[model samples]
Target: MEQLTFSSAQEILGFLDSALGRDLLLVPVWMRNLAYRLACLQEPDNTALLRRAASDLQFVGPDWNDTAHQLLRSAEALEAARRDGGLGH
Candidate 1:
């Protein structure tokens, strides 16, 4: 994940667009959710990407399963902050 720092929202979106499985599922659900979570943290569209989080994929997680759940919580907090007017677009 560290090697995949995205340059822009489009980069992440491009990856996601390519990964849209036949059943509409992304293979690595954690990656997909992480991207969306990062996007939601800053993008006006919520699902749009930004530089803050995606610029460092290292922050995604230290491990896979349980760590992903923790990252999701942090990402969710960012979203909540945005909703509460603590973060700006």
Candidate 2:
């Protein structure tokens, strides 16, 4: 595979908007550090994406995955409540 590089936050942000960006959090330390730096910029849109990435930090085991799903649901429920909208959590 060809090496992927980002010389600026814009490049990284663009990548994050792509399909491959779904694996952003699973990347190596250097890439995670880059994401952290990007998140620190406090852009609302990117912040939400960062939050979604954080939510994906869960165990792969079935039992653990269930708990993780519930945890993510709780967060979503809270956000929906804040917005006065929920599919019924």
Candidate 3:
């Protein structure tokens, strides 16, 4: 399968919204992760986006266990940092 690439968050969001609208549960896990990764690249310090991406991956089930775990860890670390005042508000 050809990999899907996104130049911006709007493109990813549009794809995801369309998928959700069509009830397309068959959207590949890698594609979902790619969207999340691209969004992260655009806004690396957005903890809320990280958490939402992790939750979104979890919602897709366990096909990509390592990627899901990594996202969860990243979100947790960012949340912890924010709580500890490691990240400036």
State the C-alpha lDDT per candidate. 0.52, 0.47, 0.73
- State residue 39's C-alpha deviation in candidate 2, in Å: 2.8
Evaluate model 1: give its lDDT: 0.52
Which prediction has the highest lDDT against the true structure? 3
lDDT of 2 by residue, 38-79 (tens): 543444333354455444444223444554455456556566
Candidate 3 differs from the real structure by a C-alpha RMSD in angstroms, to one decimal, of 3.1
Model 3: colliding residue pairs: none
For candidate 3, give the lDDT of residue 38: 87
Stretches of candidate 2 above 4 Å error? Answer: 1-10, 16-27, 44-48, 59-78, 85-89
- For lDDT, candidate 2 versus 3, the one ahead is 3
lDDT of 2: 0.47
TM-score of each: 0.39, 0.32, 0.66
Q: For residue 77, what is the lDDT in candidate 1?
A: 72
CA RMSD of all predictions: 7.8, 8.0, 3.1
lDDT of 3 at 45: 76
Q: Write the per-residue lDDT of candidate 1 for residues 1-89, one digit (tens) a residue.
A: 55335535566666666766343444465666666554444353442233333433334454444544544556567677888998874
